[model samples]
Target: MKALVYNAPYDVSIENVPDARIEQPNDALVQITTTNICGSDLHMYEGRTAVERGKILGHENMGIVEETGPGVTRVQPGDRVSVPFNIACGTCRNCLSGWTAFCLRVNPVEGMDGAAYGYANMGPYDGGQAELLRVPHADVNLLELPPGTEHESDFTMLSDIFPTGWHGTELAGQQAGDSVAVFGAGPVGLMAAHSAMLRGASRVFVVDKEADRLALAESIGATPVDFTQGDPVEQILEATGGRGADCGVEAVGYQAHDQSGQEHPELVLDNLVKAVRTTGGIGVVGVYVPEDPEAADEGARHGRVAFDYGTFFTKGQRMGTGQCPVLRYNRGLRDLVIAGRARPSFLVSHELGLDEAPDAYRHFDKRDEGWTKVLLHPGQ
Candidate 1:
């Protein structure tokens, strides 16, 4: 099988690797149809994380089940399914309590509770950016898709960003008629804005400098705030009548920067603290690590940011931070797509084959024009 393998910093290529097979009794082998190259993957591709060489690197996946183990009862051969990024054991305490991202039985490394395919320090499971993928705990992990090829692009999002975007709103406690200000306009940020609209937010503000991404935000009825024009926090506040947004989301991870491309690890968090209303909730769906030896900030080398704890304390703001529990919302979001209510595929700007992944990574990492979202078809 040909899979996308990570070689070193700023490098990845398609290579003929060993075939993926069912290794567990509850596992299912899938013929992958669509696998995404996530912004998170750039972290590993750029050597920011501890991700080793020679590992397959994709997690956002959906495909048709080719075969299933004897222990798998619900999911079977020939069923189309979406695999969540998290590789969780269904019987764990965290999984039972709806926190599948923190499942205790997945990652074997000490002190790490959660696990994901092809992620840094997550687990040993390989990813689906190839012709085949082995899904563990198939009965509980795979979300069945309807028959036919309808909504293939949209349904593909159910594996991660759609639910993750919805999870950002869930963390911020967004409600109908309330105002939301989402920091950043990347895929996840755009999805967060879309999720805000889905939940009936009276006003949704997306902050970014990119014309293409902000245009996509506006296409979904969100007001675009161009940080390059002026102070993004002030723009959000002014748009909210100076009271600030009722809730806010941090979609840019620790790699956040300004117009001049200077890396500021704490920039988005501080901006969110100022953009959101006092006592209003804030959700952080962006990636933040415990260590970044390559970070530009001297204080952030140990993964500690210069957060605005003083104002956060005085404002009494509520905060929720972590990875999305993809299983919790995939079903409902899938129905929305089936009903023609949500179209996450709108954010997709490019769909290329697996061979083009390395170039796509370079363009996306540089935030090149018109490269908003990309979907890699392994079998193409």
Candidate 2:
């Protein structure tokens, strides 16, 4: 099988690798039809996040079950399914409580908190960027697609980004008639704004420096705040008449910016704090790590970044952050997509075959040339 192999910093290429096989009794071997190249993958590709060389690197995936273990009962051969990015053991205490991302089982590299396929901080599980994927705990991990659905292309996002965005907005406590400011206009940011609207937000201001992404935000009924032009806090405050937004979702993670034109992950949260009204809540879905102490770039640093904690505490603002419990929210998001209430498919800007993954990595990692989201067709 040909899989995308991480060779070095800023280098990934398609290389022939062994075909995946079922290794556990509860596992199912999936013939991957569609997989995604996520922004998180870029963390590993750029050497920001630690991952072993030659490991396959894809997580947001949807495919067909080719075969299932005898213990599997929830799904069977030939069923279409979406695999959540987290590789969790279904029986763990955390898994039972709907926190699959922090499952006590399925270690990523080692220890607890389990692992993710083809992810930086995730365990040794191989990714689905290849022709096949071995899905452990198949019964609990696979979400069966609705019967008779044809356009599985868009629904593929249910594996991660869609549910993640929805979860972030939900954490922020967005409600009908409330205003929101989402920092970042990337795929997740756009999805967050879309989720905010689905919850009936009165007005959504999406702050981004990218013109194309901000335009997409406007097309989806969100007000685009170009962060490069001026202060995002001032923009949000002016837009909200000095009361600030009711909720602010920080989608940009640790690579945020401070007012002095310096890049810092904590800057994003600070701006969010400055933008939202007192007592408002914040939801963060962006990736921030406690790993990588010597990260050369500002975006790839550890969790100890500086932020305005004093201001946040003084404002009495609540905050939520971490990986999204995708399985907990996948069903409702799928219903939204099936009913046309939400269309995450609009985020896909480029579609390429597995062979084109190297170039895709470069464009997406650098965030160059209108590359918002890149989808890889594994069997193409």
User: lDDT of all predictions, in order shown?
Assistant: 0.92, 0.86
Q: Pick the candidate with the highest TM-score.
A: 1
- Per-residue lDDT of model 1, residues 84-184, tens digit only: 99887889889999999999988997878899988888989898888899999999899999977899999889888889999999999998998999998
Q: Candidate 2: how many backbone clashes?
A: 5
Question: How does candidate 1 score on lDDT?
Answer: 0.92
**Candidate 2, superposed: residue stretches over 4 Å from native:** 108-112, 147-149, 257-262, 294-302
Backbone clashes for every candidate come to 0, 5
Model 2 accuracy (lDDT, Cα): 0.86
TM-score of each model, in listed order: 0.99, 0.95
- Per-residue lDDT tens digits for candidate 2, residues 1-380, read 88998888888889999889888899999988889998788778878766778889899898889998888989999898899998878888999998998878788356547578887657778999999999999998999887543656678899999888888888898888999999988888998998999999999999988888998999989999987789989998998889999998888876555434476666788889999999999999988888665453544554566678999999999999889988899989888888988788887898899999999888887778589999898878
TM-score, model 2 to reference: 0.95
